[model samples]
Target: RVDGEILKGWPTPTGKLEFWSRTLHDWGWPELAIPKYIKSHIHPENLESDQIPLITTFRVPVQIHTRSANSKWLDEIAHTNPLWIHPIDADRVGISKTGDLVRVETELGYFVLKSWITEGIRPGVAACSHHMGRWKPEGHKGQRLGISTVALNQEGSEWSLTPRKGGEPFASSDPDTMRIWWTDLGVHQNLTHAVHPDPISGQHCWHQAVRICPAKEGDRAGDVSVDTGKSQAAYEKWLAMTRSADRYSPDGTRRPYWMLRPVRPERDAYHLPLKTESAEV
Candidate 1:
C-alpha cells in the first residue's frame, strides 16, 4: 500500500496523527476537537481587576514531591516556600521589599506567606513551590525534618491554620532530630486553595486566580484561612462547567472504547439505563 503510504499510521479513527480529534467532538467537546488556541481558566480576561494568576508548578530542583521531608539534607537545602512576586507587583501590592508578608486571597480564603521580590518570575503573576509548605498540628505526629507545628481551628465554615513553630533544632533521643537547623518549613497553602477541576480533562486545576496584598493586621507569616462553604461552592461551580457523558455519549457509552483509561467496564456496563415514560391516557 505504498502510494507514499504510512508503514504503520498513527493511532486514531483516521489511522494518522490527528490535528482534529473526532473523539473530542463526539464526546461533548466540539470546541476542543481541533488543535487551536482556547482560552484557559486563568486567561487574562477571566481574572478580575485585582486578581493575578498564582502559578504553583515550580518545585525546588533538589527536592522530591512529598518525599523531600524524608531527607534532612534535602530539607536543609530547601524547605521554605516564599511567594515569589515580581518587584513591581510587590510594590503595587504595598509590599515594602523581599521578606515582607503578603496575603494571597483566593475565592475560598487566603494564605499569608513571605514575599520574595525577584525578576526570576514573570511580572503580573506570582509563583510558589508546590512541594514545600508541609505542616502538622502541634500534638500530631508527622515528619520533623520539614514541617511546621500549627494550631488548626475551625468555626462554622471558616478554618484557620496558624504556625506555632517553624523548623528548628530540638533535643530528642535521635541525633538527627538534634541536628535540625532551618526555621522556615513553609506555609500550608492548600488549606486556602479550593478544588478547581478542568471541565473536559477533569484534572485538578492548580493555577489559581488570586488577589495579593500586604498581610492583614492580625495575620502572621504562614497563616492560612479558608471558608469550607465557599470551597464547596467552588467545586459545584466547576462541576457544572462539564457536559455529562450520559447525555452527550452518542454511542450511549460512558466513554469511547478507543480512549485509554486505567480501569474500564465491559461494553454493556458503559451504557446508561434506558429512560422510560409513564403511560398516558
Candidate 2:
C-alpha cells in the first residue's frame, strides 16, 4: 500500500485509488500510473456547492467547434440545434417539443435556438450537443443552394462542393453558384457563453450562466445582441496602431525584418512547374 504518495492521487488532492490494475503504471505509460487498490468512489463533496446558481458544462458528440455543419453527411444525422432540458425545467419555462427557437442567454451574450425537452439532462441543468449546424462557406456542399442542386439532385450527386470534390470541375448549371447569396447560415453557440470567473480556481468559466426562452416567429437563428462596444474599441485602437508610421518597417514593409523567417527548400520533392510548348507539341 503506497500511503500518502502524491502520484497516487491524480487530479484530486487526496490521491484516492480509482480503479483496479495489476501494474502501478498501465501500458508502459507514466501518465497511466495508478494505485491498484482504489475502488469506485464518489467525490460529489469536492464539487462546488449546489447553492451556487451558475454552473458550467459542455455539449456532447453532436457538435464540434463550428465545422460539423459543413459536412452533408453529419448534418443529415443531426439536423437542428436542440437544447436538451430537464422535463421539469422545460415545463417551468413553458418549453415543449416543436417549440420555436428559444433564447439562451449568458452573461457573455445571448442567442435564440430550438428547444428539445428531454429527461436526459438534470432538472436545474440544460444541455446541447456541440456537433450540429455548421457555418456554410460562400459555396459548400450543405448550404441551402448546395443542397437543392447537388446534394438533393439524384442526377449529379458526383459534383459535391466540398474538399473531397476539390480537383473535380463543377458543372456549369451547378446551383452551388447561388450559394454566394446565402448569408447568416447557421447558429454559433459559443457566442452565448460569457466570460465569468470561477471563485475557487480563478479560472474563467465560459459556460457559467445561461437562460433559455422560446424564439418568436421571424427571429433569426444566430441573432444575439450583447454589448460588444469594448471589442469594437479595441479593434479601432489596433487599426490606429497599425496606421502609425513607426509601426512599419524602414523599407515600407508591413512586417519587421527580424520577425520574418527564411523558408527551407525541400530537397527530395518532385517539381514540374509547367509543360513547355515544345514538350506539349
Best candidate, lDDT-wise?
A: 1
Please list the Cα RMSD from the true structure of every candidate, rounded to 1 decimal place. 2.4, 18.4
lDDT of each: 0.85, 0.44
Q: What TM-score fits each model?
A: 0.91, 0.44
Where does the lowest 10-residue lDDT sum fall in candidate 2? 158-167
What 10-residue stretch in candidate 1 is worst by lDDT? 1-10
**For model 1, what is the C-alpha lDDT against the true structure?**
0.85
lDDT of 2 by residue, 127-233 (tens): 65554334343345553422222121112211111111111123346554433433323345554444433321235444443556677665655454444543345
Q: At residue 236, what lDDT does model 1 achieve?
A: 99
Residue 247 lDDT in candidate 1 = 83
| Cα distance off (Å), candidate 2, residue 61 | 2.5
Q: State the lDDT of candidate 1 residue by residue for 134-199, as single tens digits.
A: 888889986677778899899999998998988888767768878877788788777777798988
